[model samples]
Target: MPQKTNLNYWIDYWNRTNPASDLMDEESLVSFWDKRSEDFADKIATAGGRKRSRENIALLEASGFCAEGARVLDIGCGAGSLSLPLARAGAEVTSFDISPGMLAQVQRVADREGLSVTTIAGSWWTANIDRLGFREKFDLVISSMTPAIKDAETLERMITCSRASCFYIGSFPGGRDAILSDLLSRIGKIPSPRRPPMGFLFPFMYLYLKGYRPEVTFSRRRWNETLDTKKAAAHAIDIISHDQTVTPAMNRAIQRYYKETAVDGKCIFKNEMFLGMMVWKVRP
Candidate 1:
C-alpha cells in the first residue's frame, strides 16, 4: 500500500473536521458571503486589492488566457473585481457567485463601467453544469481565493467546465490574518499540539500527481486594514470561530482584544499575505 501523502491526510482531516463542507449546501455558503458582500467589495477596491487584481490579471495575460474575445467563466467571482476587468478586456465573461448581493454588486459595477458581464447566483458544487451547458464551454476558468474549490471532485468539475485552461489562487501554507490570529490566541483557540498540513499544498500536489504540470507562482503583499472596534471584533470572530457560535465569553474576549489593540481610535491590523497562483492547461 502506498503511504498516505500530506494532501490525502489533509483532505481526510478537513472532511472529518468540516463534515458539512462535502455537502456543498448552497444556503450555508451563500449566507456567509451575503453578510460579507459589501465589505468584501470594499476590500477589493483598496490598494492591496488593486495590487492583487493587477498581479493575477498580469499572470493571465502573460499566459495568453485572456486573449481578446475569450470565453471566460469566473467561478465564485465576488463583486466583479476580476470579472469586470476581463469583460473590459473584451472577453465574454460569465461570473458566478453564491451571494445575490455579490452578484448584484458585480452587475452594478459592470453597468457603471459600461462593461457587459453575465452574473449567475449559484454554487459551483451544486449547480447543474450540463443543464446550464457549461461543461467544457469556457476558454478560461478562474477561481480566486474562493472556498468553492475544496475537494478533488469539485476541482475536477471546475476543469470540466473549461475548454482551454484554469487558474486558481489560494493562500500559501500557514497563512493567517494577523488580527484573527491575535484574537484567536487571546480567546484560547490555539491549534492542537500537532499542527495539520497546510491546506494549499494539497491541491498543488493533487494536480501534480494527476499528471498536470501546473505553473506555480508565489506573491507576497502586505495587507493592512483599519476597522472600527465593533467591525473589527466581528471580522475577527467570523474568521477565527468558523461554524462555532460566538458565545458571550468569546465576544467579550474579542472586544477586549480590540480595545487593547486599537491605535489612534481605530483597530489597525497588518499582515504580509502569501498567495499561490496556479495555472494549467486542460486537454480537449
Candidate 2:
C-alpha cells in the first residue's frame, strides 16, 4: 500500500517546488477592496447574518479560537464583517485593514453598536505591532477570505504577529462549482485562473520546516440565496461582475434566470459551496 502523505510534509514539498506568486501589493489590494467595500458591506449586512461572514465566526468559535478577555487580531477586517462578532463575543478585537476607507466603515458600525474595538489602518506587512499598545498581544490571529501570505517574507511576518494561533481562510484550487462556471460562461468571460495548490500547501509546509506538527481541518458550506426583486437580482449580478464587462447575452441570461427561478418577484441564485482548510499549532 502507498504510504499516507503527512499533510505537513506535502505542504513543505509543494512550497519548495512552486514558483513565486505574483499577487498584488498591499496598496493595490486595498484599493481594489476599498472600491467594492460598500457593495460587500450591503451584501453581508443584508444576507440574513448566516452566510459567509457569520459562518467564519462560527467556525472560529467552534475551533476555540478565542475566549472571554482574550485579545484577538482580525487582519484584513473589511468593514468589521468578522470583527464586530468577535468583539461582541467578549474578545478585545483589534481590527486592521490596509484601506482607511474600509476601516472607516468598520468604525461606524462599531460605534453604532457600542462595541469597543480598536481599528488600525496600515498594511500588516509594515504595521508596528508594538505601537498597538497591547501588553500581552493577541491570543488569536484570524484572516478571512484575504490573501494568505503571498510571499515568504509576509508569511514569516504573519507568524511573527501571532502569539498563540493563526488562522487563514482562503479559497482552494479547483474548488469552483458548475453553477459559478455557468454564470461566468454566460458572460463570455473566462473564469479566473486557479491558484497553485502550493498556495495553501506552503503555509503548512512552513510549520513543518520550523519543526511543528500543525492540526488541520477542512469544511464546506452550501446554500442558495434569494434576492426578492429585479433590483436585487441586478445588484447580485453587478456584484459578481465587479462593474466589469457583462455582455448583453449574459445580461439576458441573468434576466431569464431571475424570471424562471424567482417566485413572487424574488430571484434565487446559488453560490458554490466553498471549501476552507484551517491549519494551526500552539506557539512554539
Candidate 3:
C-alpha cells in the first residue's frame, strides 16, 4: 500500500471528522438561514461586525486583492459583511449565498448605499465553475465562517474561480456557549448533539502541503446580545436544529422557557468564539 500524501491525509481527515450527514441538507439549511436572515443582517451591521469587516477588507487591500475595478466573489456572504465594504472600496462585488433571504439583505443595503453588488443565490456545494462562467474569472475569491467550504472539492472550487487570491475563515477548537446549552436544556429530554466540526486545522494543513504559503490569523472574542423572548426562542430553535432534530415539542419548550424566564420580554445571550482565517495567492 502506498503512503498517502499530506494533502490527501488532511482531506481524508476532514472528511472523516465532518461528514456531510452531520450537516443540514440543502433545503433545511436554506430554510434555517432564511428564517434568521433579518436577525443576521442586523447582527452583521452592528459596530463590532463593521469593525471586523473593515479588518477583513484591510487584509484584502493590503494584499492588493481589494482595489478599484477588482472583480471579487464573496461566497456565503452573510448580510454582506465583506461584500458591502469591498463594493464601497470600488471593487466589483458579487455576493453569493445559499439563502435568497440572505441575498435580499445584501441587495437592500447595496440599494440604500447606491453601491452596485451583484447577488447570486446558490449553494456552493453544488455550484459548477464552468457553467457559472466563474473559472479564473475573479481577482479574489473568499468565504468567511461558512459551512459552504466543507472539503477539498469546495476549497478547490474557490481556487478554480479565482485568478490568484483567496481568503477563508473557519472556527477554532473550543469556546463558550452557555446560551446554546441552556436553550437545549429547556427542550426537556431532547439533547443538543452538538459536535464541534473539525475546523481550520485540516484545511490549513491541506493547503500548506499543497505548497501554498497561507498567511493565517486567529481571533478570539466575546459577544453579548439581548433579544425579545419571541426572537430568542426562534434563534435558539434555528441553532439547535442545525446540528440535530428539534422536535415540535422541543421548539415549543424553548419558546415557553423564554416566555416564562424573560425579564421584561427580553432574554440575554452570550458567547465567546475562537476563529482562524487565511489568505493566500492560489496562482502566484
Highest lDDT model number: 3
lDDT of 2 at 8: 48
Cα lDDT tens digits for candidate 2, 182-209: 4455544544433212245566565666
**Candidate 3 residues 1-284, lDDT tens each?**
23356667778878887787777788887887798789889988899888888887777767766468889999998788888988888889899899999999999999999886999999999998899889999988988888788888888998889888999888886776655667666555766654434367767887887788888888897998888987777777767766677787777778888888788898877888898888999863
Displacement of the residue 284 alpha carbon in candidate 3, Å: 6.0
Arranged by lDDT with the best first, the candidates are: 3, 1, 2
Candidate 2 wrongly placed segments (more than 4 Å) = 1-21, 46-48, 51-66, 128-136, 177-180, 187-199, 225-268
Question: For model 1, what is the error of residue 259's alpha carbon versus the real structure, in angstroms, after optimal superposition?
Answer: 1.8
Q: Which stretches of candidate 3 lie over 4 Å from their true place?
A: 1-4, 185-188, 193-198, 242-249
Estimate the overall C-alpha local distance difference test score of candidate 1: 0.76
lDDT of 1 by residue, 123-242 (tens): 776778898889999999988888777677678889999888999887775555776766666668633221212245657767776668887898777767788888888776664444
> Which sequence of candidate numbers ranks them by TM-score, best first?
3, 1, 2
TM-scores for all candidates: the values are 0.86, 0.69, 0.91
lDDT for model 2:
0.64
